[model samples]
Target: MKDYVIGLYEKAMPNTLTWREKLECARFFKYDFLEMSIDETDEKLKRLDMTKEERKALVDLMFEVGVPIRTMCLSGHRKFPLGSEDKTTRERSLKIMEKAIDLACDLGIRIIQLAGYDVYYENGNEKTREFFLENLKKSVDLASKKGIILAFETMETNFMNTVGKAMEYVKKIDSPYLGVYPDCGNITNASKSLGEDVIFDLKKGHGKIFALHLKETVRGKFREIPFGTGHVDFNEIIKTSYEMGVRRFVTEFWYTGEGDYKEGIKFSKDFIDRKFEEALKDK
Candidate 1:
């Protein structure tokens, strides 16, 4: 297996940090890149509204800091799910996705990690699933035209909670731009929710698993916490995924603004490095 380049998620930086601070943290942590996010907030949504010049300036700053934004996590689905029943809301969701895709192209982002929610904070049914797939097809088409990859992240939801399920869509879409971004922590949570041992079929994706969101999750409680404090079997995940040809990982967690974040960064990076090697050497 090839070596992996680990990235810090956008939430790794506290909201108080300026762009410079965030980039500095990435550089200081010696990360290969940083993951940008477009979630359900006026502040985060501003990235979609930035002028082309402004976007260029931000990208330039990242280049100066040597911390490229390689991927985008479009978490705005929690607010505007594609499977929303309301026609207006579903249309808005698609618009947000289109705008995010445009911004991603401007920023040189290679992948857009989409949330797995067909409908968030709302009931889902056959019609909702149909709407979700319909909107996703549109997004995939636009992404293909723009030369961008849209990988669906395994979520803490009843829909698309595993890589296997995501593969169903990948096959249906039949586009290289569409794939899976499985989160190990979310898998653990989903397993607990189902009262069964649900493990990710990393190899089943046939290397279409574009990225992995590495995080810790205490089942039935939280998905983001300190490393090794959850049920996630990092050893198994890394070993299985690496053998399946996964060579990219994103350490997803929110900055707590507690002690120096450098400690957390160092911990995360080193842990990933060590576990990656450990998994490779196992058996």
Candidate 2:
């Protein structure tokens, strides 16, 4: 049977919770791993006033609770302008990424998701592309030193918005540490294609996929729609991923502040379990 690792994005919580509360929420969800996006201005981290020892103690507590951090989803790109023409902004972004890399290394996490180049702007010319490549090379070099695998995620607006483009970028990088984290929901709006098409393209690019993000989209808006209520074909996606040798799959269900967190986790777990069982019987 395929081993399914269930997780949740830290951003799913309302920013009102303390660090202890966050831990309680993770326990409530009963997740196998915790995926967090650390922000520089996060008040919770500030309120904790945690030293390195304190942080380690907290990590130890999580381990004792049976939910270790499997991935660190760095939010560096939001504050620092990566892949931008602005020199100062670019430098700042790299600095933030460097800090994130160090934190991941110290925390013993292996997977660091990069924001890639911002796609909100339409001026992604050759210069911008080269900048991204150069910065990515630097990031990968650092990750390689720390024995970390850096996974670049595709956004709606970036140099690599599709699986093909993401694969192309990863191939150009030509490093074992550099790969793609395929998001099932992001590419749903590119055309009028079905979710199966997204899975097909991702399968084609599976050689470069290091991790998987399970999300769903409706029409053009991407959200945390419960599995099977949206367009993503979970069964085929999971089966193809398993065949391609992807061992880590992260479920991203953004909390909409309406329902119980336990219910969301159970619903997602049931969907994943059902799909894995189906895939196994078919195999």
Candidate 3:
């Protein structure tokens, strides 16, 4: 039997929870893994500084609860995107990537999802694209050395808003450890921006897709919307992607404590599972 590793993104949990509590939440929700977040908050960012012993203890709890944090979403790039034309910013982001690899090694995480934008805070150009590729090469080199994979996410940017653009860097880097972590919702939004219709075929990136961010997004909206409330064509996207090569998936969403969290988790789990089943049936 084939296994589909469905994980819950860290956004599903309250940031206030201790690592152990977070693991427990994953176990309670029947998820196979937890996609850890290393976002912009000072508290979240501090995880990069975790000591070896602390990391081991956390890993121990992961084993205890049967919820491994197998993937990481590296969101710090919002502050220090690697593709920036500024040398200082690019250097700082490169250092952050190095530290992130070390942290991943300690925690037994396998893949780090890289943000697509080389410089999200600024506009893009050929120079910025060159800088991003250069900096991404450095990151890929480090990740290869550390025995971890770095999958780039297609984001809301002109540079790499689709899997095809992400493939540009993946092909340039051409490392076994470098792959694409596509966000189908973001792809829809990008298609709208370009006045195109699904320019990126997930199958085109087959063998290079490490995983997926299964978030819902309407054409005009991007983040924090309820699941299935957006224009994300879950049935088609899931079917096509599963038929390609992706078996790992993380449902990307933010928890604002507006409604019942447990109920919502169960609902999403069921919905995704149903979609996966439908995808398999179509095969």
Lowest-sum lDDT 10-residue window in model 1: 195-204
RMSD in angstroms between candidate 3 and the native structure over all alpha carbons: 1.6
Models, CA RMSD each: 2.0, 3.0, 1.6
Assess every candidate by TM-score.
0.94, 0.87, 0.95
Give the runs in model 1 whose Cα sits over 4 Å from its true position.
192-200
In the range 13-52, model 2's lDDT, one tens digit per residue, is 7656655666677777666677877654665224223468
At residue 137, candidate 2 shows an lDDT of: 82
Across 1-283, the per-residue lDDT of candidate 3 in tens digits comes to 5477889998886767788887888888788999999986777778899888899899899989889999999989888888888889888889889989999998999999998887877887889888888888889999999999999898887778898889888999999999999988898898777776653556668889989999888877878877778887787887777777678999988788778677778888888888778768846
Best by TM-score: 3
Ranking by lDDT: 3, 1, 2
Ranking by TM-score: 3, 1, 2
Best by lDDT: 3
lDDT of the candidates, in the order given: 0.85, 0.70, 0.85
**Model 1 residue 183 lDDT score:** 89
Candidate 2: the clashing residue pairs are: 119-157
What does candidate 1 score on TM?
0.94
